[model samples]
Target: MSSSDIFLGETIGTAILILLGGGVCAAVTLKASKARNAGWLAITFGWGFAVLTAVYTSAPLSGAHLNPAVTLALAIKDNGIEWSDVPTYFGGQLLGAMIGAALVWIAYYGQFHAHLTDKEIVGGPGAQATKVKAVEAQEKGAGPVLGIFSTGPEIRVAWQNVATEVIGTIVLVLAVLTQGLNAAGDGLGILGGLVTALVVVGIGLSLGGPTGYAINPARDLGPRIVHALLPLPNKGGSDWGYAWVPVIGPLLGAAIAAGIYNVAFV
Candidate 1:
């Protein structure tokens, strides 16, 4: 594809991916939304549909590599996607992610406020445990809104978090590389996109407990940046400390997947 087509397709595709994906988080988490407390099954399926929509819409133009890690993996393979096009893919995905995150904020402005302001009784009947937990969290300076924008580990073990991401991304990129291996394997055919979407849902449902299955660096980083920049009321710290795990782990996972594919499958 031409550079302009690559850029425009990736930009638009990643934006839609994030809009629907992140929009589901807002729907389930933010207070007062109709889908509030909808649970993880809803999120997994929502993200699956988001991937289905974005890939089908952009495959003709850019092959719908909406994540930078996916772009990097495809480049490492002998796929026709040129190394020179890497920056275009990255640029489009990052910009698209930011736009999608901003749209989610705009769409759920009220719900965000309600969520951030929500607090249990600090010194009431359940005060002892609640107050201690709140104080500990205050020292960490992390906020609840961060989950809506990006992933965080349930347990803060670094290697474990990184391992979770790496394993999940291996499943994802491997699927992308090997799926629909007929005449249409050059890009996602209609069936390929649907199957890819289901793979994403499977990843989320199985591996999302630890770090929310970020599999895509742009999907995590762009929205985290927006979470930091947006003028939301009482939005908490963006947790810059733990950000590197998601970015590095997925890139590593993609690279490993590419190496394996080149050795065994190619």
Candidate 2:
């Protein structure tokens, strides 16, 4: 694929991914939304559909490597795309993710206001327990709405958080690599995209609890940056300190998956 095609495809695809994916979080978390309290199952399936939609739409152009880890894995595995195109893919994905996140905020502007500005909604009567338990969460650094944009751990142990992200990403990248290495370079065929979407849902259900299953770096960091930047009243901190786990862990996992594919599957 040409550089323009890769950039445009990745940009559009990842934006859609986060829009719908983050939309689900907003719908479930933000008050005044019809789907509020719809819970975790809804989130997993929402993201699955997000992947499926983004992939099918963008596959012809960029092979739908919407996630940076997928791009990194394909690069390391020497998938059909030129290694030089990796930066283009990364740039597109990050920009797209940020766009998507901002869109989510726009789409849910009222809900965000209702949730963020209201102390009752922000912390509620159960605020103390939540702050005590999830010390690295909304009360400390990551705001309550931060989860709508990025991932965070239930437990704040550094190694454990990193390990959870790594393991989840390993599952995700391994599945993508196993779906038949391809010419578009990311190996996501039409069927591959559907299967990968389901695989994402599975990873969420099985492994999302510990660290929220941020198997993609762009998916996490770009949105987190937006969360930090957007002018939301009483939105709290963006949890910059815990940000590296999602980015580094997924990259490491992708690299490891690439090594496995190269050493054993290739």
Candidate 3:
């Protein structure tokens, strides 16, 4: 694929991935939505479907390396792609993730407002509008709706969070690395998409509890950046402190996976 195709394919595919994935979170979390509290099963399956659609749509153009870790692992595996193309893939994935997140905001604008201010209802009688809530202020990371944009840990153990991200990413990147039925660049056909999607669902079901399974750096960071920038009310912190966990952990896991693939699968 040409640089332009790589750029555009990853951009569009990652965008779609985040749009549907994040859209599910928004639908489930935000008040007054039809899918409110649809539960974790819905989220895991929604993300799987999102992966299927995005990968299938963009595979012909760029092999649908929608996740930065996937791109890195594929590049490391030397899947007939040049090292020079890695940066292009990363750029497209990050840009696409941000765009997808913004689109989710637009799609759920009203729902976001209602959810954020639901408790404060109208900001009228005895509202604490002047001062931020103590819980919001004291808690340094993750706000009311931050989950819609990025992952956060349930228990907040640094080592545990990093380990979870690393393990999940290892499984994800390894799947792509070991998948030999299709040409690496093809991600060929819907079968490839189906396998990847099912793997993602499996990972989410088995490994998502700790850190929400942010196995992809662009998927987590780009949307988290959007969360920080958007004008959503009472949106709380963007959790910049924890952001490095997702990014570094996934990259590290990808590297380990690449090393393993070279040693065992090659």
Candidate 4:
């Protein structure tokens, strides 16, 4: 692939990844009234589907390493990747993630407003009721009771979340690469999809309780950047201090996987 194509593929692939992956989170979390607390299962399947689609869409062109950790792992494993391509791939992944996150923000703008307003409404039900009573007394009209979506474990620390992301992503990449190798020459065909999906499901079931199982640096950082940039109401902190975990953890995991695969299989 030409440099331009690779660049564009990375950018577009990351965008699609975040849009589908993060969009599902926003749909389940942010748009509580409509999509209230869809939970981890939804996120797992969403990510799995997002990855499957993104790979199918861009693999023919750029190999669809939307996550920087994946790119780094591939570069390390296969000497064919040039050193210079590292920067291009990383840049494209980050940029693509940001674009995809922005798209998710746009898609969920209205839901965010509704969610916040609903919170305020539920906070002072008595006062709101009194106002509605007054309005009803005045013959103006009866006010409506708006229900807001709520979730548990609201405050998440940067370190803790990053730790979760790293652990999750490492497992995810390791599974993908390992199963991919096993399936490659064995005529696994679409069984590759089942392998990928099972890996995500296992991670989600076992490791997703914390940090929401980010597992993909591009997946977390890209959307986090958008969360920082977008004018969404009540946007949470960026947690930049722990950002390196997802980045570093995945790389370490990939390296370990590579080492293990080399020693065990070779």
lDDT ranking, high to low: 2, 3, 1, 4
Error of 3 at 185 (Å): 4.5
TM-score of every prediction relative to native: 0.92, 0.93, 0.92, 0.76
Off by over 4 Å in 3: 78-80, 120-138, 184-189
State the lDDT of candidate 4 residue by residue for 107-187, as single tens digits.
877777675466442235646774554344234211121101101112346556555665666676666566653222211
Off-target runs (Cα >4 Å) in candidate 1 are 121-135, 180-186
Candidate 3 backbone clash number: 0
Residues 116-203, model 1: lDDT tens digits: 6655422245457755765665556556667778888888899999999999998988888888322534456677788889999999
The Cα error of candidate 3 at residue 266, in Å, is 0.7
The positional error of residue 255 in candidate 3, measured at the CA in angstroms, is 0.7
lDDT by residue (tens digit), candidate 2, 1-266: 78999999999999999999999999999878999999999999999999999998898888899988988888888544568988999999999999999999999999999887664555556576654544545555877789999988888899988888888888888888887345444548877888899999999999999888999999999999999999998787898999999999999999998898888887
Leading candidate by lDDT: 2
Best by TM-score: 2
lDDT of each: 0.85, 0.88, 0.86, 0.61
Clashes of 2: 1
Q: Compute the lDDT of residue 38 as modeled in candidate 1.
A: 97
Ordered by TM-score, highest first, the candidates read 2, 1, 3, 4
